[model samples]
Target: MTSTVLTFAVSALTFVLVSLTPGDAARAVLGRDATPEQYRQLRAQLGLDEPLAVQYWHWLVRAVHGDLGTALSTGQPVLRTLEQRLGPSLSLITGALVVSALLGVGLGVLSAVRGGAVGRALDLLSMLGLALPSFWLGLVLVAAFAVALPIFPASGYVPLTDSPWEWLRSLALPVLTLGIGGSATIAKQTRDAMLDEMGRDYIVLLRARGLPERSIVLRHALKNAAVPVVTVLGLLFVGLLSGSVLAETVYVVPGLGSTAVTATQAHDIPLIQGVALCFTVIVITVNLLVELLYGRLDPRSRG
Candidate 1:
């Protein structure tokens, strides 16, 4: 319920901010030499001459019906454009999430279980992962894998319909770029959670009962430690799904993030609003899923 309200609030906020932002979308489209009269006519045609509240209300109504208005640049339906981009974005995000979850949880578990040089090294790597900027990491990956070794293709998106293998190959660098950053965050969270769980009295009790360390850690500690990690994973999943603009831009993928960037730069209000709303919906859905997971993780949270 709160997430739904937040979605609406964010959508309204996005609309207001975009509307208040300086620059005339009409003029941007018409370019310089467009006189005041030309701007007036264009604004009226685009319904921009209406009061801001009226404009927002109109947008809200259409938005509720899944009609996000038409893009001024392409004259295509905004929803249609988003629909076209959704698949590639989902594929990239899914791949990244899987990689992050596996690497992060595995490394974190190992780090917790082994408290020596190996653990220290994994901890250092996690720190580096957090410190590294995503865009720079993306560039480095491109240089090493795409340019130096000529492994994965440097840029461009391929549809699954064309070739499943090619589609997967195209996303390698972008996935790594997002996954590496996400894994760092997840790893840190997982490590902390595991450490906390390990120090609990119950863990000591279980150890005293002669249960093997592996069994105790895997069956007991991991389940309890997973709650917070699951929360972070939900957030990371949303971030990836909404499209990592930096990663997508670098990879030249026609994902939601890239489309939003182009629309915002072009001052395509309808397109921008549509994209922002879609992101809000995705976030709300993910958050709700996280809450559900919380109930499962800690039965006390159910009430």
Candidate 2:
């Protein structure tokens, strides 16, 4: 029920915001030299002459039926365009997510267990990760890995169907760029959670017993600390989606991020709304999964 409300609200807000932006669909399609008569006709044809409320109502109705309308720029269905672009974006996002989770959790555990210099270093790195712009980092990575060392392609995506190895190679830099910040964030959260868990009464009890230090930290403390860590990871998923725009643009990956940039540049309202709606849905779905995982990890959450 909450998810439904959020989805509806996000869709409506996206439409309203896009509608409020400068320029209309007709002008975007007709160009600057179009005469008054042509502009009027185009406006009528595209229903841009209608009230904003009526326009939103009509769009909402169609969207409910899976018809996201046509892109003013390409004259193709918005859903079709999204489908064509979603694969690359998903690949990039998935790779980044995996990289962030592994790196973040590992660093976090290490820092929490072995404090002192390691913890301070993680704090500094996390600050840098959060401060650095994804696009700037992407550029640095490209220069070092692609230009200086010539280890990977600087731009462009290769479909996994064509060559899985090439696809992974192409995504490697963008993933690192997008994932690094998220990993830093998760590492901080995991470290805090681990520290808290380590200081709990149960931890002392386990230490007092004959349990191995490795088993206590990994099997018990880590498991107990997982809920909050999972929550941070879920939130980071949304950040990753937003950051993909910069990462994809810098890397020239033919993904939804690039498509979104193109749509916004052309004032493609339908395409923009479609992309926003897709992102909102993805975020909500990931959060829901996180909640379910939370319940699984801590049965108390099920209540």
Candidate 3:
């Protein structure tokens, strides 16, 4: 119910904001020197001369009917353009999540279980990750891996259908940039949750009753601590997905993020609106999934 209201609100607000932004769409397309007559005709042809309420109503109806209209800049169907770019964005985000999960959970468990030099080192690394900007990290990685080592390509995206290896290679730096930052967040949350779980009376009782330390930490503590970790993971995934704007721009990836940037720059109202709607939908969907996962993780919350 809330999601439905949010969707409509976002659509209306996005259209209003984009319409209000300083710039003439006609001039954007036809150039600054276009005469007033040309601008007037272009506005009429594009239906921009219509009343705001009427234009919004028409757009809402068309959107409901799965017709998102066309991009003012490229004249391509907004939905089709988004569809074509979806694959790369999903691939990049999924890779980042996987990388973050592995490194984060592993280091978190180690730091919680073993408190010594190794733990301190991991803590320091995570702090660095949290402090560094993804774009800066991306540039550094490009310099070292792409330029100095000449191992991975600095920028450019390859479709997975063409070759999985090539696609993964092209995505390596961007994924690392996003993943490293995400890992810090996940790792800290995991560590804190584990520490809290470990201090519970049940854990001490298990240890006193002759449970193996390994079993206590992995089978008992980790399972019970997972609820919070799951929460952080869900939020991190959404953040990374949204944060792809920087990654896509830096890597020259033709994903939704870069497309949104391009649309805004060109004053492509329909394209921008479509992108905004898609983002809101994705966020709502992820939140719903997270709620379901939370219920499963903590049976006490099922009621």
Winning candidate number (lDDT): 3
Whole-model lDDT per candidate: 0.88, 0.89, 0.89
| lDDT (tens digit, per residue) of candidate 3 on 219-303 | 9999998899888888998898778988999999999899989988888888998999888888898889889988988888889
Distance (Å) between predicted and true CA of 206, model 1?
Answer: 3.7
lDDT of 2 by residue, 151-232 (tens): 9999989999999999989999999998987888888898999999999999899989989989999999999999998998
RMSD for all candidates, in order, please.
Answer: 1.9, 1.5, 1.4
In candidate 3, position 231 carries an lDDT of 89
Query: Model 2: number of clashes?
Result: 0
Question: What digit string (tens of lDDT, one per residue) describes model 1 on residues 32-58?
Answer: 989889989999999988998898899
Regarding lDDT, does 1 or 3 come out ahead?
3
lDDT (Cα) of model 1 = 0.88
TM-score of each: 0.93, 0.95, 0.96
